[model samples]
Target: MVASKRNRVLAGMMLAIGFAALRSAPAAEVAAVLRAPDFKLSDQYGQSLSIQYPRESACVLIFADQRGSSQVEGWVRPLYSRYQGRVTISGVAELSSVPSALRTMIQGIFKKTIQFPVMLDWTGRVSRQHEYRGKAAAVVIVDPQGLILHRETGKAAVEALERCYEVLDGLVRTEDETPPTAPQDGPAVEQAQRQSRQNGAGGAVRQSDQAKK
Candidate 1:
């Protein structure tokens, strides 16, 4: 009888521990330090992208829809222009009412006008994961490690983007001091071409040696 009672007590303790873990799990925005959550999503080109991908001296900038403002096309476009290849720019549509076609067009417009990577987050999971507050906002300056290095919620003046660039550049300088690792895949776009050449040459070399034999 004593053993059975002890078993019951042990079970109760386990349940309490599990409850505590669930309560302590990180929630976006509320957590004190900004940690980037890894997520997989498709980009404008329908290519799979993940937060784990290594970036060379670049940051991720997210812009979302706001309540009062329809869309600040002019402001965002120039920011894209000035920073073009140096940074990856993405627009997140927070509203449930947004249509797929509209999202695609907006992405296309930015891809052409801004000439940078643009991503669509239909479920707002990315926004929530990043801990973005406010009905609509812009969160600029995510590091290559996917950490939220700097964030500005409201309408960021032209200076905001530039400031983010400075932060990222500083980070790159710091990383340069560290020991080297595997070869960088270079920028996100060039990665595909790099991989293609590697794969094509890799098999051809084996075949050529066989023919020589």
Candidate 2:
């Protein structure tokens, strides 16, 4: 009788543990799904821009301060070479610390240096919203609806780039594949192209090789 009573207690404890785990799992998942905050800021050319989510392709936002800006090219070049059409890549300069008086000079410098549009964050509000790390560049990947799929902060070293690649590989589809029932013209075709590039055909393989070099 004592053995049976002990068995009952053990079973109750196991059930309680299982229930606790189940309760916590969803909270963790919800916490992980951080949605990107939307805002408009002028680019290097002084043209205003904002990330309109639920876009045709996934978006990559690279946030950097003066120190972190040095690492931007290491991440951007390879990523652009391989996933240019597959993803929308943009840069955000964390220039909130710059004095208001020097803003025009800074913008001019950016225009001269960067060929692409880099949204200038004069107020720092966007940087804070995105949790910009001042020490290292923060690479954030957001899906169509602006849900942040992946984020990492550090130098764009090979290993770090590989990790980012892995996240992107999971999110983006290859160029050739298409859904059977979906129409070819609109977002469905775009969605179909967002498949895994590693599993894609020869052209994709060539692009991947080029990115490594």
Candidate 3:
């Protein structure tokens, strides 16, 4: 009788452990850090984007809805333009935080206005993972290789965002450091190609002469 009871207790413990494992959600956000919770989403252009924050270079991410979408063009695009290929710019549409009735209407408006990759956080899973307190929006600047450099919530003014931009600029590699790589058709590569062709021709001629002998 004791052996049967022991087995039943063990089985109950196992069942509880399994249930707890199943009920767990993704990890919560790590503040002031670039251990950015990964997310896969589609943008307005139907482009599939997977963000693993703190890439090779700095990146700026905006989590918002229609409330702050309009201002993206004003301040955000300038960041994109200033940084150009130096920094990454992305946005997340926090539709799950919006009212059900207003979701569609807000989505339609931003879809037309936003230029950069605005990922749809449909269930707010991504937002929750990032711990986005529901404000008009939240912005984070991460340095290259993923360190949270700056974070802001609400309508962060252009000047204030620019101050954050300077932080990102300091982290970016200088032009002399990260020059544009030359194409394969550059002078050095073209010279190498010419030499390769000459070597092949010489080898063929030598083979023909030996055959003639």
Candidate 4:
């Protein structure tokens, strides 16, 4: 009879512990700010970057193409120039999105000319997920809170550049702000198509999970 009582007590203790464990289990984190999908990419300088999407500062993510590179570069490059110390501005070179044969020329010659940080998206995963209608030449301007303030097709026009600046004009502080890069308006769409024909960037490059941390 005493052994039976002890067994009952042990069973009751197990039930109580299980109930407590269930109660103490963590809840899923509710985001306080609009967040972008986390991305781990290396810069041209082989520096690893950790991007916590819902960051405190605003950022401009420009996925540039070689054809519309001059125009898009003209626009987003200024953000880095103006807010070098403040904002998270970068031009992610969608190199992997291009033909593997042309990667050398673009990365070696064209991309090398840029003054700003033109990151290498080797797998093309990030660019593909956010590609604008299969067009990789795109730009996304986000606010300090991480809300997408403005976005444009990779080969959008001069007016789109204005919309982008209009969003940033009120929020950021820049001591040496400059104007947009260039104004290649006509045949912009055609140029984008022609450029993409040359670059056959595709497939999800496999990366190890350890790369995340």
Which structure among the candidates has the greatest lDDT? Answer: 2
lDDT per residue, candidate 3, 55-116, as tens digits?
67777787775575554555576677788787778888777756778756766765787555
Cα RMSDs, all models: 18.8, 13.6, 17.7, 24.4
Clash counts for all predictions: 1, 6, 1, 5
Candidate 2 TM-score to native: 0.68
Full-model lDDT, candidate 2: 0.82
Candidate 4, residues 14-123, lDDT tens digits: the string is 99999999986532122234445567787755577755666767777777655546656566556666666677776666666567787666566643675555677777
As for lDDT, the candidate ahead, 1 or 4, is 4
The 0-to-1 C-alpha lDDT of every candidate, in the order given, reads 0.62, 0.82, 0.71, 0.63
Could you tell me how far off, in angstroms, the CA of residue 138 lies in candidate 1 after the best superposition?
A: 0.9
Candidate 3 — which residues are off by over 4 angstroms?
A: 1-31, 98-109, 174-213
lDDT of 2 by residue, 18-136 (tens): 99998754211112688888788999897999888767788889999998999899889999997889989999999988999999999999999889999999988898998775877
lDDT of 1: 0.62
- Model 2 segments beyond 4 Å from truth? 1-31, 174-177, 181-213
Lowest summed lDDT window (length 10), candidate 4: 200-209
Query: Best to worst by TM-score, what's the order?
Result: 2, 3, 4, 1
| Model 3 backbone overlap count | 1
**Least accurate stretch of 10 residues (summed lDDT) in model 2?**
23-32
Choose 1 or 4, whichever is better by TM-score.
4
